[model samples]
Target: MKHSGSILIVDDNPDILIAARLLLKQHYQRVKTTDNPFDIAGIINEQRNSDQPIDVILLDMNFSQDSISGKEGFYWLKKIIEQDANIVVLLMTAYGDIQLAVDAIKAGASDFIAKPWQNEQLLGAVAAAFSHAKDKQQVGKLTRQKQGLNQALNTPNFKFLGQSNAMQQVFSTIEKAAQTDANILITGESGTGKELTAHAIHQASMRHNQTFMSLDMGAVAQNLFESELFGHKKGAFTDAKADRIGKFELAQGGSLFLDELGNLPLEHQAKLLAALQNRQVTPIGGSKTIDIDIRLICATNDNLEQAVAEGRFRQDLLYRINTVEIRLPALREHSDDIPLLADYYLNHFAQKYKRNLTITTHDMASLCHYSWPGNVRELAHAIERAVILSEGENLDVSSVVGNITSNANSTNNPIENNNAYDTFDLDILEQRTVRAALTHYQGNVSHAAKALGLTRGAMYRRLEKYGL
Candidate 1:
């Protein structure tokens, strides 16, 4: 396998340099040789500035005749580390001794190798050094990211926002689950605060002090899936100009939240399964597999069981991610909390917009009575808009409820389902028709799909999409 690793060979003998370069180039993507050790810094600096930093250096211990002490190798090793602490330096010499090897290691050299090294031994040593270099680079990044994340956690925006019986059960589950290392799967409709729940779990876990990295599976493109989850070396792709850590590594000793998990393609699902099972990831264009430690949490609105039955999602991957599944009740199911949720958003938006606003007693019913098809998220947006238009007056119920009704994309309103079927909102109408067909067939998905002129897969997708 071709490795996306850069190796620099420094030696006074051109023959040693030539042999090393020829062997290394076959395995490594970039291999450069120089007979002069003085040019080491210049070459390293140039490459680092160009975003292709050298990962490993093969340095000869004796550049001058009768130089058996290996002092020159130690000097260069120290200098190389000073320039880039992540670079792994391997010292080689024809004068082999245990004391010299120990000194080389103490001086920060990765390994001490004798000249005329076996091909297998040389390859094994370089590969190990390259992997060590990558790990060092990633650890540096992880430190910065951890600091940033700690600062962010001090002022979080997502909140657990309900006290209804259904929600109280969810809260109780979270309380118990948060104390364990079990992989969690959170299932809910759009805008139902799935991510917020995941965040809550992270905060309550023992790993709360570390990072909580979130990756939106739906938003990530297919080509960049591996890089996003498993990192990439510089020059791995056109846009990869520098070594980059992935969500898994950044979330070391913490949690990784994979949002919209159902949207991940089947092929990528297999790749993810492999990584999850192995507890390691081989980065794109890099042969070395990095061990990962993260508490996995996946959230999705789609019914994964349906997808799995239809062969759209992998069953084994499902078993890996959902050690414990938490299904959040929809907003309509917990209508008792609507007024509380509405008041919270109203006060929040009013404070944010610097407005003196309150929901009128008469108008509060509209918020409680209507089905929040878009759930809490859509409610927050509606309240924010109403606050903007309140003009320091009472919030207009029309401004909030009217906006939700006019949004034909709101498919979960049972009240609207009873309408004259006269509206031109095709999305709503399609959802209604699908539900009607299911009801008529007593939930026979095949018959419902046949009546709607949809394939079974298409029917399953719609059911999952509409959360039927």
Candidate 2:
């Protein structure tokens, strides 16, 4: 018959405290009784400090013999609410004090019970109060979660642009997949707007207003993978300073976008697959497994089929993620969209840098003609560079396409050429590019990584590999 919550009873009569405590103790997990209503503040403070806060308070009116106004009860009721607005309060009054009890209820009391109350009525009232308190706590938790999500989504860059037939087909697929909870896997070359596609799906889904959290696998080190995805309790590890909520928990009741999925280690695939299969995750160094509800969307540039064949990736994990697959065409395949994309980038950069710049027909022709091996990302970077370096209102095509054409013509490999490296050796070119990016950003790893189209963790590994 015991309920889940604790209760506190305050009365001026010792007999009333003894009778109330004995009756309530049979139903509540913990029952505290006090004969002095003046000691209420101290008792509440002690409970608060102990972290075993009182859930409901049963306060009696008319503490003094001549006190029929119930002023003392009203004052204590206000004080209790001030101490903890969430705590449920029930005022106890005599039959003659019913009017005063009604006034107390109007002020702030959760409910009022006559002094000669039936046992069933008292139990039901206290149970209802306890339920109300729990509901308040849950609402507060969700409000904080929503605020955190809003702060995380402040980086407004979710534009999905492309009018080509391939892009049209991709959009069609996204529209169909957005209504359901099926797992989606987006496959495409780097900078082909895979993350943008994921965002589009999330926005179009029913959970659009909930949350859309993106986690880049390439940016997470292997050592910290479990903790990053499944969360960890305080003291779980040497560096776990506090209990942390993982991406799975944060994205609950919404969508979770796992970018660079191919970068996930083979050993960790089983762990991810298990969580997806069971719909639950266990935090590091924690025994409890928390249930999770989320729509999964994964993106990867790597050919997962080839990886599976080569034993570098698990086929089971791929099956779990690719229930619905969307493939994006590279920039070269959709060269017709170059003008639209170029104009978009031009306007974006112009607004960003607070400059007025126009793109000429000649510049458009040059951009369309070049085979963008780095895809849309490289083109955006080129436009940003032109916006920053150009002196006139018109964009400088020479500066924009000069090094691009030169590099493409100099190298035999188109991929290497698009990288803008003069050297033929790929390793030395990679090392040099990483070093240059780091230098350009003045040792800011995140900026350098973004400019180079690499994750921060990947850039760190490259820096260590080249001793930069």
Provide the TM-score for each candidate, comma-separated.
Answer: 0.59, 0.63
Tens digits of per-residue lDDT for model 2 on 40-72? 888888887988888899998778887777788
Mind giving the per-residue lDDT tens digits that candidate 1 earns over 361-446? 76676677666665777577777777887654888757544633444345545425555555778776777687677656544455
Instruction: Summing lDDT over every window of 10 consecutive residues in candidate 2, give the lowest-scoring window.
Output: 413-422
| Model 1 poorest ten-residue lDDT run | 400-409
RMSD (Å) per prediction: 13.3, 13.0
- Which candidate wins on lDDT? 1
lDDT of 2: 0.82
State the displacement of the C-alpha of residue 217, model 2, in Å, after optimal TM-score superposition: 1.1
Looking at model 2, residue 435 earns an lDDT score of: 54
* Per-residue error (Å), model 1, residue 321: 0.9
Alpha carbon lDDT of residue 273, candidate 1?
95
